[model samples]
Target chain A: MSTSTTLEAPKSGTWDGGNEPMKASYGKLMMWFFLLSDAFTFGAFLIVYGLTRHAHTPYTGEAEAFTFSTEWWPIPEKVFNAFPGFHGVDLPLAFVALMTMILIFSSVTMVLAVEAGHRMDKKDVEKWLLWTILFGATFLACQAWEWTHFIVGTDEGMLLPDGTTYHGASMAFNQYGPPLFANLFFFITGFHGFHVFIGWTLLIVAFISTVNGVYHKRGHYEMVEKIGLYWHFVDLVWVFVFTFFYLI
Target chain B: MAHHIENDFQQTAEIPKPQTKAIWRTFFILVGLTALEFLFAFTMDAGTARNAIFIILTIFKAFYIVAEFMHLKHEAKSLIWSIIIPLALVVWLMVALLAEGSYYYESITNYFK
Candidate 1:
């Protein structure tokens, strides 16, 4: 019923800095607490988006008028293209879907690495951590490609009847949907892509540390556990993004 | 003392026994579930039905991820509830906002016409 009840402190434990009253280690517990607050922040953004979508006035001009149809979020398929080689091909956010899978699969590898660390298998930890890093990097690379595709118009710019060139990432919407949708799309997903970049950097650091015998010397791989928390958090955020932005 | 230290090092060097087949079985089940999600996404049209299915499948995926991968299922009941209850708040907030927003939107559209 109360916030305190929801956030009830973990059990008291010997490692919990005597008098701290929490059973979990300071670092691990802090990660959970941080994720909890971050979750609320994202929740607010999504709720506002829902509110805005409800307020949107359907564009009901001529068939050629700039607007969205009920079919899909107006021309999401037209706006998002894969790369240079695929000119005029309608892939419809295929690249973003791939990026989502990469992140989710990396989360799998991260958990495996954490499990290895728990069992004190340094070599297994290193292997899986490396795999996690590779997946993260792949995700980052795909995002970069997506960004470039967004900024650059397809082979020839999409020409409207009025002859105004419609860049894929334009501030104007075509028959597909609202212009604000594109603006919000770039802003929100770009911000998330930045987080993915940071996550990749952190995983690289953990990977290097494992290779250099840092955790082996420390007698425990709590560092790996901490990074695993971060990696999984990124994946969790993507779950929301995939649902709200793409599927919903 | 030196002999005892050597014995401890030897024990540490020995690899721990692998987990039973149950772990791999669970992992394969997760893979199958993921494949199912993909199949639904590709085959289904975007509508209320597709959205409902996506939501259900995503929740299932998340449950497995949290329970098995994150080890929450094995944790204390209190700990598990601590994570679940807050997340439930988030989902509730999303649903409420969407419903209210859609209602207001409909009212405004009707007023303009």
Candidate 2:
């Protein structure tokens, strides 16, 4: 009885040997830690990108139009100057802005779904989850289009060191700035896009489970909460990627 | 067997009341910050000052997403600190590696010259 009371004495404290140490459930706590580690993974990628970029000299030419040069780092706005359905028009950062809005809106929808789940409103949860999924898929489609445009070169191809003109970007060649530019672009954004794909799939799973009355029967919607953490983390990473890779 | 399964499905914790107002407010804040980023992208010159501004804005956006959208703010203090404190290491990594990168750049330029 004395030992039991001793254990109970610390019941309200964080390390009280309670099931919830940090006032979060076991699954939610695990999810938070997972995201923390995931943040490190993304942090490493962006840092490596920054490190490589620091190695290059900045472009200092006075060119009005986009030109492929291996002498210095290409101006980002010059390289990414195409908007969908606007052929031959020089619109920089517009498409990525649209992409950002799509992602942010999707994140809002995801949080709304979590909010609905808190109230045990299954119909509302399902509706918002569907919206989030739609937005996610739309964002993925935009990424696909962006990648295709990047791979299909602009009118003026870059002159390679070997006396050949390279039009598109690959693992070994990039018309934009340097080969490392394309490599990092593919690595960082590809990894991020894969995260979006996984988040989308998870949303679908959550949606299906909601439709099947899983959360309704289970008496709580912590599943939605856990997945919401992941979805928001993806959005958060993109904010940095947009700033570091595109804006600056 | 049925009773045991039913017991497993019990609610784990109390669900807080819905904060629809705050959610919409956060949405608008995010949109406003993004608009500001776009404005700066065009209006500001490309240099260290502009990059600093972008980094600050990005951090603000990240805060909103993690604190509000992910509901980290409402979580326990210990949990919040546990996540934020460790992320300081990332800042250290950035400082150390970016310095190394610049050193490499200097090495190449100095050697060739």
Candidate 3:
């Protein structure tokens, strides 16, 4: 398929006259563009998050001692205090921090895969890609646990403006605080989770292709590098989300 | 036959060596930053100062990820500028919206309550 392009003499120049004006492969450059656009999408979400959050009355409750109310925004640590296997213990930011570590580690593995691809070390590529996929799934699973806790909130439900107590959070109501909080939480994290799912699926495909020696036959592992760009972008988005959503 | 084969095959560039050491170094830096952020989140009181610190640290982490993890730092200068220049607009959007949002908050507190 690519033979015709290679038939011509290999042209060379940094900026004066090369086919790759940016010194990057066409696929890689296109992937960078795609990621840049994706960054804007996430940026908009997080900015809107900041705007809406600022619009709400700031939470002024003492640290770790908070109650749900509609009068102001709920403290993030108080809201996301649940941890697996630690029932009734308020471990604020711990689980989310663990999730952050998982994602960062996974990004490490992904870059390793890309590095392996550079060396055309197919076995290492397969190994690191598998590790990346595993970590991605683990992050998703952590998110699922978090969502479950969010949806099935604390037993001591808060009183709504209507003088009725409501438990848990849905699109219509939130036991934590304002409705916008739940909305942004579901939307921002949901959007990010979907990206992780898609990236995970792409990693699976890349892993399978590596196992089948597809890139081996093609004489280049550019596909792994492209997907690596995507996977790293996902991790990059999570760092901001970790700060704006959970931490700040 | 050899010359014909050489002409038929594409001239593949030399593959670059893997920088595992740099990768590990970046990973450690990211982890340390995250730990520091966690510390600040808990120790510091909720205020503009804490929030500003968080934003600055987040930006630092972002720079490392983009430059090292995504390999944007090693890319051609033209490519580097192409990506970073557009993101400045996002910063503009943020400042504008934040100012607007605070205005909304003030109006709500003054009138709605």
Candidate 4:
């Protein structure tokens, strides 16, 4: 009957602001702090990426004479040139664009769901929450398609005239871009995608709980607010990804 | 159990209301900037100009996301500064390391030549 059960006292009692708990709800507040720390970790990754990119030889001039070929680190456009059903059409960076839109739209739906929860509009909450889940699923589907497009070349997975497949990573080079670019791309986005998967699972659980009248019985929707924070955090990280990885 | 409607109602009253139209306006601005980034990437010859355009647009989008979606603009000045200052530091560190690394790379390549 009460949501108070979800709150617990910290061992140190440091969070005890007099009678109030040091934090808010145990689960929700902890998620916020966790996201803040996670933000720092991603910051470190981006900083390292910038450093490595700076160290790489630029794609021009006398430097080309010293290397095996003047091709330089494959430009991001040259590397990620994939789209559905346009064989060799050179639709550079199309897939990443779609991924970006998917992430941003999902963030929109998440905020809407959170808004509905605040209004205590149960039907709106259910609808918007379902929409949020659908958007998340769509984003994941797009990511999978992007990976497939990356791995198997544009059509029938044919090799280029250079005798290498259209998509594959090598120590010397990558089909989509420089080897480091592809490597970091997979690592960073893959980790973020994993977080989305986790967020989706939490959202689904919350949706089911709402259907079962859990929040109705408890008289509050703080759980939805907490999950919304996590969802928004994911969108926030993608903003940086779009900037540093895609744009720059 | 006593029903503390007074406190509960007061808390509810203090919860800031969503400015729907303002949020929509900010969202459109973000989408517009993203379009500009894509256009620059596609149209411009790859060079310093393209890179500058991308970085500028990215900063614009970041500003909107933080100010609008995260509601940092509505928060206390201390809270705003707390988040912004650290973010600025991170960006500075990234740029500094990148510039220094580039210089070192140029020197090493020239020596080898």
Instruction: Pick out the ten consecutive residues of candidate 2 chain A with the lowest summed lDDT.
Output: A1-10
Steric clashes per prediction: 4, 0, 0, 2
Off by over 4 Å in 2: A1-13, A63-66, A161-164, B1-18
Name the DockQ score for candidate 3: 0.50
Listed in order, the DockQ scores are 0.41, 0.56, 0.50, 0.30
Candidate 4 on A29-138: residue-level lDDT in tens? 46646776788778877877777777776666442232222234545565566676766786767877887787777777766766766666667678878988998998
Fnat: each model in turn:
0.38, 0.79, 0.76, 0.38
Q: Tens digit of lDDT per residue, candidate 1, span A1-248?
A: 55564667876775465553344567877777777777787777767766666667634343234343333244343455354467677666566667766877788788888878877787888898999989988887887777677666565555566766655565565333555676767766776777778878888888888887677767788888877877777776777676666655
- Winner on DockQ between 2 and 3 is 2
Question: Pick by TM-score: which candidate is best?
Answer: 2
Interface RMSD, one decimal, each candidate = 3.1, 2.5, 2.7, 4.5
lDDT of 2 by residue, A1-248 (tens): 35553334434655656457688898999999999999999999999988998898877656464477877888888877889899868898889999999999999999999999988877789999999999999999999998988888777778776887878788888788888999998999999999999999999999999998788788889999999999999999999999988998
User: What lDDT tens digits, residue by residue, belong to model 3 across residues B1-113?
Assistant: 23333322322444456769999999999999999998998888888898889889989998988999899999999999999999998999999999989999999889887
Considering TM-score, where higher is better, how would the candidates rank from best to worst? 2, 3, 1, 4
Model 2, span B45-66: residue lDDT tens: 7789988989998999999999
Candidate ordering by DockQ (highest first): 2, 3, 1, 4
User: What class would a CAPRI assessor give candidate 4's docking?
Assistant: acceptable
Off by over 4 Å in 3: A1-18, A161-163, B1-18
TM-score (chain B only), all candidates: 0.76, 0.82, 0.80, 0.75
Q: If scored against the real structure, what TM-score would every candidate get?
A: 0.79, 0.91, 0.90, 0.78
